[model samples]
Target: MSTRKDSLKFTMTSRALKLLGQNLYARPWSAVSELVANGIDAGATTIYVSMTEDPATNTGTLEVLDNGSGMTEEDLEHYVSIGFDKRAVTGTLKSSRAPMGRKGIGKLAALYLSNEYYIHTKTAPKAGKQFDSSWHMQLDFMTDADKEPTLREINATTIPTIHLNEQFNKQDSGTLITIPEIELKGLGTQAFKSLASRLAIHFLKDVLPDLKIYFSHQKINEDPRFKEVEWHPAYGNFLLLSTTKSHTYVQDKIKRKVLIQSASRKDSTTVETSITPTPSFPLNDFENADIANHISTSHNSNTISGAYFPDPLSTQTYPYDLKGWLALHATIKTTLAQDNDSTFTKNQFFSPTQIRLYVRGKLALEDLRPYLNLTEQYANYLEGELQFDLLDEDDLPDIATTSRESFDTEDPRFTTLCILVRDWAQILINERSRIAQREKERLVKITANANNAYAKRLSQSIQKLSESKKRPEEVIQEVHLGLTDNDPLEPDAHTAAKEEYRIFISHSSSNKPIADIIYDMLIELGALPEEIFYSSKDTVSTDKTKQFKMLEKQIRETITDAATKICYITSKGFCSSVYCCFEGGAGWATRAVSDYELITTTYAHKPDWLDAGLQTTSIIDQTGTFTLNRETYMLFTQTINRLVEHLNVGRRIKQEPLINSILEDKIPSDYKLRTRKEKISDYYNPILADMITHAGKSDHSAEV
Candidate 1:
């Protein structure tokens, strides 16, 4: 639409257009993720992102180009058109069960990253003769807001064939997406490298040996970089089920079996089973009082200890000695169509991740396996990708999000998939345990039993476990849960973690006041003190060298031998003392040995001495555990009643209307740690903020 004045004319608002251009990409990360996805979708082995800044102007540019199947002119027009609404009204759309386009909206995500971008591309030999050798398209919406975007054929003859400043390269027939608009701050090479590394750890994996991913200018060969996750000798060889190439992942309920899609589609003798065993280890361990605590109380109110693996060791490959499950490493899906929308970021996983349950080279759970998405239960660790055959000929909507990093959870297949996975979760924990046990026995025989007697015993104990219907083994998946700082601002989060958690606390004597307070608070909430792992001054002897070893020995004996959840407390003493840091060091060292979670929190505004409880509370919250507080605890315990119900009833934690009632009010945040008045702070202060901002519950509670 255009309007013209007889004597007056309006210049095209280039500035408005520029703003639109700059804001085109919703998030910078999304833009980069999109480029990476394109490569994966095109079968690129190595994806490199080169980030550099020109110090003189301080204006920076990030270049992310890939060696995937380059698009032709036709693909550019049909798939990259602006404001395309091919799938907005039509719920998730999947056809042939293998396509990955959100009709076409995923491309505009690039516009949101920066105002200006240059797209360079090349085509494969199959359809090459029609297009230019290498064409460039530059668009900057932020600088010129009102003008229609201009696209023209560009000559790349004079440009650098090789990007020297970026020191990057491209494959013979690939695409290059250069983002020339870094408005806020120019990222350093290190930041880009780190992101690239994290992505590789996630999307690019060891499980699918055929699939390959590269970061930086360097290639990622199998080495220290992509090591398997080690659960230590204590956890036994957590082997990666290299179920051979014959294993086919099937999700009959998710889509439908398309006999025509497979050259071999015969039904097998694969048996379906249930996962009914409660994991060998209890969450809070209320069942047994004889166990010792490895970590200590937080010494603060509001939050409990978190799960953290010690450093160095925490990051090491799976300690099983036997090759860990690569399939579990960064959840991999061999079928590209089965992946989330390729139009969005290429290598991102969607939430409510589900795992595929396979048995005897066949999928036991037709669709879902590992993740339990009762959405009712508020399961967040439920993230993963199921790799199976395309025997099911079903139409699936694009599995990618707007940015294309993950799947479109709203799709109907998602729920159907969940039902399928739930069945597998039921089966694996029950019948499969027998099979896993058999495999373990065979593996044990292969080891010749010299020094791993303890591992053998642990596996034996696991095999002998009594069956509980929850089927804990089904919870296993290859998803990495990363939580940044809690938005001290988010409304009360779901504390459903209550049913499925094993916590470990670590602290020092200087903060005992706060630690004890935090410990009591957690205990009231159902956490056993022994699981708290209390440590004091005498625990660390004057012998400095022995400090690390001593701490390791005690903790290893407790956490490794006992816990599933781990948390670390940071007080002034812990932060100031080299011994304490070394104790922290020991925690990091043993992550390869024991899967202990390490989370640190300290008081934000309180004084160093008086705020001991505050500091302890801060660290617990930092670990990112969903929290509950004193008032809620009493009400919760009262509602459920009988410690026996909470401890052994085996029923899932039933959330009530009162649970939502906790939303408006802080559970009395004014009290100090450990005191009867203070125990109300087990929350990450979320409910507190909620009361203040929305209902003033904290202040009104004092009046009541």
Candidate 2:
């Protein structure tokens, strides 16, 4: 074999070389990258960040100061230049590094984060130079005449302002990158904790494997207070083997490898993750004769089967080094070990961890957003990441991106890559599922224990409220609710949850204050805000419809599925006007079944005459029988709380599954088809019977 080194000359002048400027990387994390790259380049033992923010613009002001070897005047010139390719990034690292940015283009990504980026340094044996550049319009104006590099000498005056945490002056040498105009999009205090957490996790696994890492003022990686950090592979350190055996078996064997322990809670540990080669598995290889012409490898049915993968999953084996082994990885979120706030950063939400498929030790595919909706999905749970590696670039050319941050699916080797990735994905997803189940069970047990403790605390509060002669001022400030809708306990076997119901709200203009309070009270009591309708001037929008969407909004916002009765708080306001009568009538007519209630201490001397010419309202006295609004709030809160208690959190719940439910088995007899001609007079009894039956079973029969 003969070997020779080849070289190419750059005929283009320094000025002609394209200055990528800011439009280099895609996202905000680029700033994170530039500094980290410098740290890796400097071979620093520690990297500290002082990331500040301005609420007005929701932007960041971050400074990454490290204690790595500094640059000299000669080195500084080339260091600041746009041509790093002319120089070498390879250095004596504290340890080896795969180099996060393979394209040597991440420096341009920094321009995406800040309008102004300043690099100040004080290296060994020479005074430091200060260079500040404006990335704004750089991408769009890279060719503009006015565009010029901004450089200056480091002097005493600029030192104090730019040198944050001035420990660098007396020290040996290091680099400082100041993102003066950090234009963070959708970042805030909420994202700060999140960004730090992500950096900690990524650095822990890929970048800073040999040393301890820190974030903020906290020792995220190695504080004595915190246990040692490690990501233990499930199969310990297993040998990666490959053979001429079926690729499906290769996938199956890969699937059978091991998983990593959960960093979070016990239930959240990864255990069942592995690639499967079995044909019976959903994410395995297959063969399709119709598209046979497309395959170039001239595979028999068995070989095509290796290339064939399921749609969406592409369950097929990914080609690897015809001789080397495949490497796959799974992820787990430390539910128990992690801080509760780990899943978010500056309002940016992420899953606890992700299911990443890899081959030959490179990331191939991952779904960060199962549905691309962390906010829309199980809100309380979101935060995760994935790292994978596939076959050697030679065997899986189409399987890897040039930079390898992404995968190239439609490539020539894509079919095999799809099968491998799909199998790996299933394994990773399975691990995540197991962890999720364990987490849920653990949460349930913890909640049950907490509830027992809560019950005792609630007992004390109940006692105090009962014994107190004068109610606390808090009671007066709180919103009030109306009557309860306790379905009569039937002597016969009862069904599960009841039928569709509404919580009617009746009010007069004079009592808007109380009525508003009542509406809030009902919501706190677990009533669907949609089930309660309120009359508000502001509720209407400019695009007014004849149906008066305002009324719909008012009702929908206040009502919920569990509501089934109306609480009528009447007063002198009621007997005096049409406003009061209309309010009551609206509540009555708006529901599938309307139950009215009145709150007061005094009964009308002549009740019917006092409410003459108006719709009928069931009135109750506040003197007894749960007359107090607060009492109703408590009652309803308790009832709804029970329903909530029964319905498990983070798990889907259906009305039909509720034990001993209402509408489930006993639909009200009245729901039977009533003929338009059957007559209003003949309908009352049968309709009522059906109503009673349905009231005892099933879902609300409608959305609130």
**Alpha-carbon shift of residue 27 in model 1 (angstroms):** 5.7
**Candidate 2's residue-wise lDDT over 1-704, tens digit each?**
87775986544222222235334434454347456656655656666666555556655566666766655555555555553432234342223444333334445445556544556565555356443221122222344434454445544334322324465555566776666556666665556555555445444343354444344422222222222223322222111222223333333433332334433222232244333222222321324422333322333432223332123344444433221122223322343222222321222353333433333222233333332223322222322223323333322333434333455544434444444334433443444456557756755554454334334433444455654443543221111111112222324533222223344455545544445544554454344444345563234445546335555544543332233345565655555646556545444443322124444312451235222332332223343221223233333333333333322221122122222211112222333535333433242233223332332232221111
Candidate with best TM-score = 2
How well does model 2 score by local distance difference test?
0.40
Against the true structure, whose lDDT is highest?
Answer: 2
- Candidate 2: list runs displaced more than 4 Å: 1-18, 21-23, 27-32, 40-62, 67-91, 96-98, 101-105, 108-118, 121-173, 179-384, 391-417, 423-499, 502-563, 569-585, 589-600, 605-704
TM-score of each: 0.36, 0.42
Candidate 1's C-alpha lDDT?
Answer: 0.37
Q: Per-prediction RMSD in angstroms?
A: 27.3, 19.4
Whole-model Cα lDDT of every candidate shown, in order: 0.37, 0.40
TM-score of candidate 1 against the unseen true structure? 0.36
